[model samples]
Target: MSESRDRRAQFGWAFYDWANSAFATTVVAGFFPIFFKSFWSSGHPAETSTLQLGVGSALASLVVLVLAPLLGAVADRSRRKKPWLALATGLSVAATAGLFFVGEGQWLFALTLFVIASAAFFLAMVFYDSLIVDVATPADYDRVSALGYGLGYLGGGLLLAVNVAMTLWPEMFGLADRAAAVRWSFLSVAVWWALFALPVFLWVKEERDADTPSAGQAMREGVSELRRTARRIFDEKPVLTFLIAYWLYIDGVHTIIRMAVDFGLNLGFGETSLITALLLVQFIGFPAAVTFGWLASRWDTKKAIYLGLAVYAAVTAWGYFLAYEWQFYVMAMVIGLVQGGVQSLSRSYFARLIPEGRAGEYFGIYNMMGKFAAVIGPLLVGVTAAATGSARLSILSVLILFVAGGWLLTRVDARAAPSPE
Candidate 1:
């Protein structure tokens, strides 16, 4: 059970990020909303459609928020993290592949599948995050987590580039038009995601704890353990404070990532600009995440995270005034500079705080906070836009979250955790 660095196992784990990021970049952030609004919800008003999209995202996140902790607990107690991860990933792949059949005017079907796929994606991540403890030691957690995010940027970005080409130049691909190309792109993600997930499934081993009770007893004990876990977290001031800060700041970050393209669309920015900006974020994000890993080794990890939050705050402020397409590109680049940094650091930082055997349970709580934050960010933006009838104003509201999160983060003691072992 030694947590020595194993390059093959490490790469296997990191490849999962490469595998699933296709869904994040292509389907969720890039084309799906565009397709949903222009095709599926064609007849609906802009405000109504955006609101509905937010509602769907919120619902999906909420489902994950509720279930993540329970499943994480189960995975830890039974030492069945891979099984849970496999189940979630398999279902998500199926749902993503099914998107090929959701033609125009099928908003209900499209949104339903999106929700199912998104929830599965986020839930699967709980197990994946927990596995960091099982794979890499605490000393290398920052590097390892950053490696995964970097691969996510590169892998997701690469596919998105191909998707953009297929969408814009459908004739070259011998497709009917952009819509047909988009359909094929969705199918491609299914294949890409499932294919790259095999390495981890084949190579990484899930270390089981000492002989536990029967399955039924383990589940019951898991529930009891969750109650104690809650109390333990509350008693750990540093972890509690960090979670609160993360909950607030990441809400703003996720909101911006999820809604940036739609907001630009509402401003009448052309599709070319929005898509190109997304590519910029993805490509820049790769190096930026790796750089943050190095920074964490020099500057304190928490300090580096603070710097990322500062950049996010600036991005939020700039988002309010975004008018020209070039301005959007600038903002997107700035976001790329810090997006992966903050998220990767947060995961590694949290990994250092939790008890070793309870990694799944603790990371479950971490994922729940993230899922719950996702719920709020989208809802907030949608409500603001619906009320003001201006997407620009909605972008400004995210600033409050960053400001609050940063202030709370200053109170967290980065070195306040017991030995993770």
Candidate 2:
């Protein structure tokens, strides 16, 4: 019965990845840029629309960076991670659903909704990630994290395929045209995201603190706890070094994910190839992500992550030389091999380092570091593209981040350091 319950809980937790990935694949990655340029910001130059999108993304990341640690600290003190997750998820769903109503020539309205939805998505992930400690043991962390990411790829991919079909063959779906189909696709994402996310709130239960403090007192203690967590993180050299390494490489990884489709389009690769490439990533990533987990169990976690970083460095270099659709497809395949492994191992590895009671606070910093990378990645890519008048050169510029991140990763002592929090 205990084993059965654990299995159910684990699946429930993993489904959140399935649920939320609809947003990641369909909205943010697959369709949003194309929709923004072709419809919402129609008549605007592609470069202008791309810069605007970057600004909106940066704004969303800034909000998450400011709020992640504070809200995480409060949730830690209140023992209310699930509740906060629910609230953020709700906001995200609502904002995503609202996107269906954003008509053409309303780029400002579109940006507003996108920013709100993006912020909510990032905020909810902090709570969800902290729950990793509650659901699985250290021994299982790598496998379980990989499972979550694998399922995410599957779920996100499935939905994106449907959305792509809708865009390509709207009349078959009883829609008026591609525009209407895209709008409905946005609505479907909201439903899919909300429906799949329900299992986490329903089936997974988190242990609560026995002592209840007043709201004000909890806030005060949370601030103090935040300080302690920060000190603990810095004082522990291994984790700090890993985070610095993660910040740099993950920035490059994220930059690629965010800009890949846009970069391809800018290079005159038509929309079909870009969409096809997106689907390819989702399917390929699922198995590759799981393979990384198996590798981690047999090998050192740090070593596995280093291997992922090395692949990403190569992927960036390949991106600089991409001149054909086949090459883009090849790049996507390589990305699938390493993306999930690196991210999953990093999360599970960090979970092993943090103290038991402060997972929320510590994961807050983890998420913040991720969001901070969002800010830097887009800015770096956008500025480089703007300055060079060539997106290919911009791809080359990202190699610096991977190199620096890989070098710093070597500095982190492979021994797991105990958290003093």
Best by TM-score: 2
Report the lDDT tens digits of candidate 1 across residue range 121-222: 999999998998767888888988998998999999999999999998999999999899998999999999999999888878888767866678768877
Q: Give Cα distance to truth, residue 165, candidate 1, Å.
A: 0.9
C-alpha local distance difference test of each model: 0.87, 0.87
Cα lDDT for residue 314, model 2?
83
So what's the TM-score on candidate 2? 0.92
Candidate 2 clashing pairs, residues 3+ apart or interchain: none
